[model samples]
Target: MVRILTSFVWLLICFSCAPKEESIVQQMEAKGPIPHPTEAPDQWLLAHIDVETTGLLPGYHEMIDIGIVMTTLEGTFIDSLFLRIQPAHPERLSPGARAVNAFDAHKWAQLGALNRSAAVDSIISFHKRAAGDNHVLMVAYNSHFDSAFLDHLFRSANKTWREMYYYFILDIPSMAWGLGLKDLNSAWIMDRYQVKDEPHIADQHTGITGAMVNVRIYKALLQYRQDLLAAVPVP
Candidate 1:
């Protein structure tokens, strides 16, 4: 009787320590429609963002600077935020990355660049002013690249990226393709739309400049699509 009771107690302990399975209902509920950040569900603002990173990979690389340009759905300028972040792990910076952004440690120190925490705080404040209570939809030329680095930055600062922006990202190249633009290359699309040319020199590649260019490209695409639809004539 004693051995049987002991076995029963051990079984009880094992059951208690076992990991709980997630309920399918709970998972489905969590994926239910997300409330629109703005009063009008269809009218959330766009956040055109660009980031200059220390490397290509997220966990291994770090964001050196970020540029965010907020605009209305119709592409009217709202506000902008640019932050130069002092590298937390400079040793991990790739030589090719340095060549691209001209990441001079001395110049960054002289400019008094914000550390990760301060940069994250500034980003949050900027979003608050631009988005108010709602989240902005992220737009970028190569969104995945920028979003991944930004995600790492936010995580490192112990902040949630979802609070500031939506999970769905709008890609400029994809938009161009959807609009029947044959060339998906940024420079080609920009030239097609008569937008200003991006800088040619490697070191001239900065976040704010790229962000501004991307925003222009997005606006151009929107205008092109509108013109095309207008030419179609109403049935």
Candidate 2:
């Protein structure tokens, strides 16, 4: 009788200590859907940004190149900025990253890549010119990845990400997922939306090329949503 009672108590303790599984509905409620813009589309601007890094981690890796394609919220072309930033910590450059980005030290040197300070200044100036007093919305294929590196870059230059951009980021994959896309991969989404093939070669992928691809994907997704809504007959 005592052994049974002890076993029951142990089981109860174990159950209490175990992490509870959160329901899908609870998770959805916690995260919520991406919020709609409170203001008119034309009133805002989108900074389609892409950055090529030395590695994956922000502080460990350095941004070697940054590309920003500014557009009106409705996807009207505004202006673009591309900066080849000289890596501050060359020692941190990883072989995998080098293979992916095809980082050529000699070529970057010949191009006169901007130093970290100069790169940050240029980015700030670009945003000021594009947005004036308003904060530009950041749009990226993988916003969390790019934003982490970008925020680190800004911090390294004694600046904050919020100085030039809004707090909320617009991620291409998230947008596609929200639009009911089953396959979130860029290739799949592009094919589904009939977006043109990426022009840059895999070995020589540039930041500008990535930014352009992301912009096109975003525009295509927007159009797809519009067409879907339009197809539904109204009363």
Candidate 3:
């Protein structure tokens, strides 16, 4: 009887693990690889994004703030969006993160704070409006850290993260490294290009400010790439 029950449980497990029908998007994704950032489409929306979290605890962190600045490839501003997400776990705020983000006990109750679903909706709406038929590139200073948090945010919010942004994320460090920047810090590269901003102190380093910093860094990197190509003698 025990053997029969085990077999029944095994069958149930296999049934639950079976793949479901793929959506159209999933089918399309399976067809080909996503485009790389270097291969810009005819029209593309570049969104410089930044997020401030409760901590650096990977999936455990709660996003306390978000900033997005959308624009064309030439840096023509399109739209900007900012959100303060009410933390699901305000108690998770670390000492360092608390100091950097500067969130107080009353901060989450402010008029700007949105719940996770609303925050996700706001981001999707902004990106879609700016993108249209153009590809969207989510640009961040250090994409891995930001993207990991965002992925968790979306998953936790019951939203599809891919719908809001393209598959390829453009990282500033990659460009900095490619251009021979030894430090690989956004501030260092920005200083080299003379892109000035307010100091990254406690309360002053807002998400919007961080996003704008990313935009300047991206613009500077593009110019450097252009200069490199121009300086290279054609074979």
Number of the predicted model whose lDDT against the real structure is largest: 1
User: By descending TM-score, how would the candidates be arranged?
Assistant: 3, 1, 2
TM-score, cand. 1 vs. native: 0.81
lDDT of 2: 0.80
Candidate 2 TM-score, C-alpha based: 0.80
Least accurate stretch of 10 residues (summed lDDT) in model 1?
Answer: 19-28
Residues 1-235 of candidate 1: C-alpha lDDT, one tens digit per residue: 9999999999998775442222322333454366675557555888999999888999888998999999887778899998889888888889889878988766787877899889999998999998885557999989899999987887676665666677789999999888777577766667767999557576678788888888899888888888898999787
Model 1, stretches more than 4 Å misplaced?
A: 1-43
Question: All candidates' lDDT scores?
Answer: 0.81, 0.80, 0.78
Output the number of the TM-score-best candidate: 3
Weakest 10 consecutive residues of candidate 3 by summed lDDT: 19-28
Q: Model 3 over residues 94-148: C-alpha lDDT tens digits?
A: 9989889887647677656888888888888877777776777788887988888
Which pairs of residues collide in model 3? none
Residue pairs clashing in model 2 are none
The residue-level lDDT of candidate 2 at 116 comes to 90
Task: Provide the clashing-pair count of each candidate structure.
Answer: 0, 0, 0
Model 2 ranges off by over 4 Å: 1-36, 199-203
